[model samples]
Target: MSHPVVILGTGLAGFTLAREFRKLDKETPLVLVSRDHGGFYSKPMLSNALAGNKTPASLVMKDSDKMSAELGAATIHKGRTVAGIDTAARVIELDGGERIAYRDLVFAVGADPIRLPIEGDAADTVLSVNDLDDYGRFSERLDGVTSVAVLGAGLIGCEFANDLLSRGISPTVIDLAPRVLPRLLPDAASERLRSKLAEAGASFRFNVSVSRVDRAGAGLKLTLSDGSVLDAGLVLSAVGLRPRTGLAAEAGVRVNRGIVTDRLLSASAPHTHALGDCAEVDGHTLPYVMPIMQQARALAATLAGNATPVVYPPMPVIVKTPACPTVVCPPALDASGAWTVELTDDGCDARFHSGDGQLLGFALLGAATKQRQALVSQVPGLLV
Candidate 1:
């Protein structure tokens, strides 16, 4: 009997690769393993789910069995934790010592929420909505909460704040940076977005972080670095996400900020691959959906007997904040550029230009977002 090809996750990456691979070759036996309930859902919707009045149950697009049938997977292992991988033996060990051999193994394990070590009694009570399970519990906690204190002013944090406001629950946003979206947008662009969100019942506190969290009656009392205390019905930690590398690292697969993979999305070992938020392809770790789609297409081709290297074009992320409505394409890390911005009553148009007068990136807010395609055409591809 031939060993079946196995995938270590059921998230968008795993399912997408499976779907794409089946389109080219269907004879190979396929299996999928998931640690959670194993359902198909758009993870990006979690931040703005409240605004659409969507329940947790409604967010799930397809259950595991349905997805398995649609993708032509022979085995869909739901609620099964993959404890370890024996790359030499070409088998995956389960939690209970059960092992299954694989012809090829793909790691779509995804990432984890970064947890800060806060010196407080109620630090463990702070919540982060990373996955569907986390979102379900967060929704449960929101039943009686009247307000939220969001830690971070980045993409997810700001979107959640906007969503909270739409539900009539005001949010107090705290960030260590002096401005919101410190890593993605220019100062002037961030300020315009901040002004709009503030007008819609969002409060911003910059250059401060939570030093501690203590339970105060039915709410959480947060102690700030400036010796100030803030109270909120619920505390949300949207600090950031770190790619999952423990499992691959333990298996002796090259792991860095993420599981290191070559242009073909292959690990150091033969028949081993990694993609999605877990894989750092040629030193680029993009956790967004667009890059994931690009990786999925390329990895699927390689798995279907076609060796194809992944390429990334100019992909701009649309920030899902109804209050501000922004789109941003960040410049390369090593690029030397300065932001040239113009702010108007309708919106802010900001461009990151190279020294020789070339457009490297752009941030468009409100009405200026209409220029997305035009500006994107000017930006060069991240990887050709």
Candidate 2:
């Protein structure tokens, strides 16, 4: 009997594992399922779409049929979701009354963009750019809009602002935090970045919350808690992402912020694994390509009987804000240490050093980004 393996999701993690597994066990029966179109595209490309002068269609590298053919794997482009999983029987039930069995299963369901609850007809006007389909839909509405309001001044928000500015559309960013990218940058570094973007025509309103949003004639009027309103042609929400963990949780797979996995990417269930933005490894859910790729390799090896332990290296995220150029390896959220910032004329660098002066994290922006390699080398290994 051929060993059959099933992988959920068609994003980077799913595709990477399928390709890796094929290298070692080509004869194994592999089945891939996805809710979306299952086309292969870089997730990071969504942020730089406008700056790269590319449409959503142009960014697609391959569709499901092409990828399935190239990998020699069975692909189910079923829009129906995997409703439940029976780990004891090693079978999964789909929403469309389909049942599939697998010797090994991988979950890479990725994440969902968080949408805030606010009152307004304009609330429907605010959209988020998460997947390729979302990007295509968003690009279509940008043709006639002159000004945009971006909620959340973090990495994605900054990238979108830069992209909009590149297209001659100035975006005004609104964040509840006192500084931009509060999760990544230190106060000094964030200030420098804000200054740079401001020079590029990106206005910001910090320490403010959007009380409500409403349709104002041809544009949107966003009311703030401070009794002020800002008008814009459109609004984009980039307030971060929440991992899709409900399915795993319902199946009794341990879940925190994401599906809990061990060093080998194994979930609580036997012969079952999880990775990518959907997997919480050692309490860390990194929704980035690099960490997901690392998890894919280790999990693939484990599935192939190698029992490889996933080793997480120091992964510094390179921010895609071309206007101000930033890179950050933020300290873990619960870490006890704080960062000290150093600002220079050309850029900003902030070091997250422990009480004992041990470097734990760092954020570099503009000319200071050249320190990424050396700084990354100084931080301790994530797995260690």
Sequence-dependent TM-score of model 1: 0.98
Q: After superposition, how far is residue 365 of candidate 2 from its true place, in Å?
A: 1.3
Say which candidate scores most in lDDT: 1
Superposition-based RMSD of candidate 1 using all C-alpha atoms, in angstroms: 1.0
For residues 1-384, could you state the per-residue lDDT of candidate 2 as single tens digits? Answer: 654799999888898988888777777788888888877888888988998788888998998888888777665555668979999899998887789889998998989999888788778778899888899888898989999999999989998998999999989999998989887888888888898899999999998978788998988899987889999888899989998988888888889988999999999999889999889997888887778878888888888889988887888998888878988888877767878888888888889988888899999988989999998888887886
List the global CA lDDT of all models.
0.92, 0.87
Off by over 4 Å in 1: none
Best model number under TM-score: 1
Per-residue lDDT, model 1, residue 345, is 94
Candidate 2 minimal-lDDT segment of 10 residues: 71-80
Question: Per-candidate TM vs. native?
Answer: 0.98, 0.96
